[model samples]
Target: MNDIFSVLPDLGNFLVGYVTLTGVCSLRLFMVMFIFPPTADGLLQGVVRNAIVVLFSSYIAYGQPIAFIQTLRGITLIEVGLREALIGVALGYAASIVFWVAEGAGTYIDDLTGYNNVQVMNPSRSEQATPTATLLMQIASVAFWALGGMTFLLGTLYESYHWWPLTSSGPSMSNVLESFVLQQTDSLMQTIAKLAAPMMFILLLIDFGFGFASKSASKLDLMTLSQPVKGAVTVLMLALFVGVFVDQVKEQITLSGLTAEMRALSGGHQGKPD
Candidate 1:
């Protein structure tokens, strides 16, 4: 009984470390699904891909046997423990914000097209969303993964451990909260604008076209006929731009340098000293 009690701390630390890493990876994948438009190629490989991703992420966290052993040290338990969980949530939500651009844009489009009443049950979040919005979300998710979003996320997590190690001396709770809010608020709006800008531009053209058609055909009951026309245009535009959008997303993810930026943010905390 004495021996068991002595080892309990070590055991608890190891388990917590492992679970924290796993959960962070899972949350990353979840956020990607929520935010980005998925590519059609990924539709069939959905669950399998996520499983593989998590497995790979585990390797990233514990691949160093020595580090894994070090993480089992009973010191810094309380602080590191809480930090890991909060960081996981923060990273996950960041990804979600980026994805939400597609969701918000889709919602706006549906409302404009008179499809707001139709709802789709999204299995990912187990929530109801507009069908067009849901579809765009899925596509964005696929695009996120297809463009190596998992790699970027995992890289960010790894960088966190290296740059933001848990320390007995760290930032205050108020400081953490203030910095997090300020950082997220600044970036969230920018990310959403970047993702939605293209779609909104296209939609503006769509609106203009409809307006012109309506004016030219005064006797054709344009209001009633415009719905189908807009829907068709929306569908057509989405289909035509799917490939182009995916490529653009890939470029954006690369250019954004999310992994490096994440490291910088993590370092801002009482990270591990090199």
Candidate 2:
């Protein structure tokens, strides 16, 4: 029919726009999603993950014009995709920094409490980690989901398109981007110290007390007794502080610094760390 013929061209244009946008958008999402447990790769799960990313990208990119894909050539298209992937990876790993901070703080406690002597296989990573470190990492992963972290991640991804479009013909300016990473590193160190400080201080007192007892009661074998005492103390402290610890973990997991990163990516003035 004449009416069907008239609508077909518009339908074809819409399909072309959507396919191009989905390809650009989904690569970044795939990189980000794989960094989380729920979306990690398994044969069946990978397929589902792919479907979800494509759908979400399509949903988000629905109104955007993707005619820019027509302007890209072989090398240029590959360059754009590589840049998009790197951006996704960089953004994805930002989530893991909080996990690392939690694990680091726990490992430091392991050193203080003499628990580093024992290593446990982490089910998620399949690597041996000190018991406390393994525990904290698991806890951080839980807090990531329970505290709406996925929302923040997706929000950052959505906002990213505002600055770094598929049409970007060049790379993000390095000078603007440099300070963003430095600031994140500084924040990571500061967070580690903050989380570990209280436990460190208490454990130091126990060590000091044990040192004095060793001198005063030389025959008592306080060295044998001290490890158990420290273990008990660590357990008690962990129980008492875990609620607050989760709260702190919640703070670090947010991609709140992303707005600044977006501005920097676009060669705009970078904002200070949030």
Top model by lDDT, which number? 2
Alpha-carbon RMSD of each model: 6.2, 5.0
TM-scores for all candidates?
0.65, 0.79
Estimate the overall C-alpha local distance difference test score of candidate 1. 0.61
- List, residue by residue over 1-274, the lDDT tens digit for candidate 2: 9999999998897777567657876888889777753344521266788888888887656655445645445776677677778777767766567777888899999998888989998765666899888888877777766777777777888777666655554444364347657866887788888889999999899888988989998888787777789899999988887788877556666656655655565565332211
The C-alpha stretches of model 1 lying farther than 4 A from their native spots are: 1-78, 167-169, 197-220, 251-256, 267-274
Give the lowest summed-lDDT range of ten residues in model 2.
Answer: 265-274
- Error (Å) of candidate 1 at residue 20 is 11
Each candidate's lDDT (Cα)? 0.61, 0.72
Expressed as tens digits, the lDDT of each residue in 1-274 for candidate 1 is 9999999998998777677656543443444433333312235256765675576657655554446435533554444555555655555555455556667767877777778899988655657899878887777776666667756666665565555543324445466657876887777677656655666676667677767887898777666766787788778877976676566666444324666665555555553332
Best TM-score among the predictions, by candidate number: 2
